[model samples]
Target: MEGRNKCAACFRQFNKMEHLVEHMRISYHSVHEPMCGICRKHCRSFESLREHLIGPLPKVDCERIFKDRGCDLCLTIFSSRNALWAHRSTCQFSRPNNAILYRMASLGIQDELRIDSSRGKAVALACKMVGGGSDGSLDLCARVCLVDEYERIIFHAYVKPTLPVTNYRYESTGIRPEFLRDAMPLKQVSRKIQDYLCNGEPIWQIRSRSGRARILVGHGLDHDLKCLELEYPPMLIRDTAKYPPLMKTSKLSNSLKYLTKAYLGYDTQTGIQDPYEDCVGTMRLYTRMRSLAHRTQDYPLATDPQNRNNYASWRQTELERMSPENLLELSRSDYYCWCLDSN
Candidate 1:
């Protein structure tokens, strides 16, 4: 079978070993991998999983229910259509924002919060939490660490949980009640962090332009931002967990602990987690990625006239006419890389 260039998992035959390797990478058919909850078939990627649910030959029952309650982003099927609707607003590929903003909009504080730009240098921050959620419901923020590009700790604080504590998960959190007893309020912590992120500028202006708000480098930033009830534009966030090349073989995310050990030659979060250590590790990873040479001095911009037409509309022969480098340029990245902006 090996000499015959056969894929054992899918039983597909290939002419060359290189083609088989590419097939294995694309098929990602492993026994231990995640399987579709409906058909129980394993997928190599989320795109393939989506195809299984909605493609031309999709599973009949799964497709029917998915139309009513499926989440396009996570491929999760909610219990009800209403639940699916509620999840849709926040189920975008980017992180979710709470409804807290609607109340602020009604109060007209949205404009009040917008001010001139502050022009701050790029910095990184990381947060740690204990007792994730009440009664196994949600995670709460416990500690935060903000460091500048030079690795200087600009702000560090222990946060008091607004909700009653439930499962401390002490083995990993290493947080004690006494540590948070005298900590800062959640609102106060949020405001201070917002001010730091805003860098004396209004959030609106920072959102509109670059070089004002600092670039945030962290792992699982979506979780951290959600716990703190904070929001930053997705473009400004550099999440190592979500980066494409760093992902697992199945195109799923790899844990920060595994990434740190694999890339940095060390270990972390063995017992209790440390926000500062996480922050430093994330910043190091960010810097390393930013330093990669994509080898193009002038990369194509999204708005370029040549890029105006969607690649899908191009004729097969037209695409075939393109050079490999040109095809690579036309292709989209699996995930957004901040280094692309720098280039």
Candidate 2:
């Protein structure tokens, strides 16, 4: 079966191995794609995925096995009957009894203060932009939201733009002139956010892997920071738009809306976009990527930390001569893999 020239993710078979290689080169499939639990085929959405599983004409093999091992709540397939049975106990997502699960979580500020500060934790940030300039073509940060790994709201504020608001983009932002009228000034908002992100770290102590500072996660985070007139250590930030594995094969960034729906199995930004929801979306995405189980590597890029091997021009002939499947196996992500965060 290894010699049959089938894509491991989409399961598309090719007459020639080179065709499969080309498909992989442009498809940009990663662990983030909405995938079939059994067949491992990537689908555009959960709706399509559901259809593929049990719709009018389902995949017979997958449907048969899914009936036995699939957890209907999360649609995950377990390896054995025991595994499925074990999963059932915790698969109560539809009706979570907050009293039992969120007893400590509801403590809010008290719960947050109890967490140890010596270890680094991820938090998500999102900003709502209102239109500025005459035709409302310029973006102005009018509001922002920040949330923790548990999707708990840490900060939510309406920001008074430094520049006068020309258009509120009310249809999307749900903001009005009155909201900004008494809102926190831009400078104050920026200072407060910076302080929260820095934790207790002084300027000199701030580093890429600082536990004192929160690791910032967001989609188009630079734009959000720019609007706030704040700056953070580059190494301390994780921008979903810039993460190599999450980007398009063309190296272009996908919108948060698209990434959320494609990878998260849900729709977003369909109506008025809420900053807290955006924060949760980015947080979910970051944690999902950070949770990748790629084994620890000792070199370059997505490989071992010590190995700096890249496809140098001197190796062009060697690369060309290798079998297509081997070449595909050799190909690695150009940027740091999020799995290294665990290391």
Task: Give each model's clash number.
Answer: 3, 9
Model 1 ranges off by over 4 Å: 1-120, 132-137, 297-305, 310-334, 341-343
Pairs of residues clashing in candidate 2: 297-304, 298-304, 298-305, 298-306, 299-304, 299-305, 299-306, 299-307, 300-307
lDDT on C-alpha atoms for all candidate structures: 0.63, 0.69
Q: State the number of backbone clashes in model 2.
A: 9
Model 1: how far residue 322 lies from native, Å:
6.3
Tens digits of per-residue lDDT for model 2, 1-343:
7655445533443234446445555544443344688877765434456667776678999989888887654567899989999977754322112243223322221112223354347878999999888898899998887778887667777888988888988888777676666777889888877877888456457854476677899999989999999989988899999886567645688888877765675677766667777887888778767875654434524344443344445765575567754664544444565666766
Q: What global local distance difference test value does model 1 have?
A: 0.63
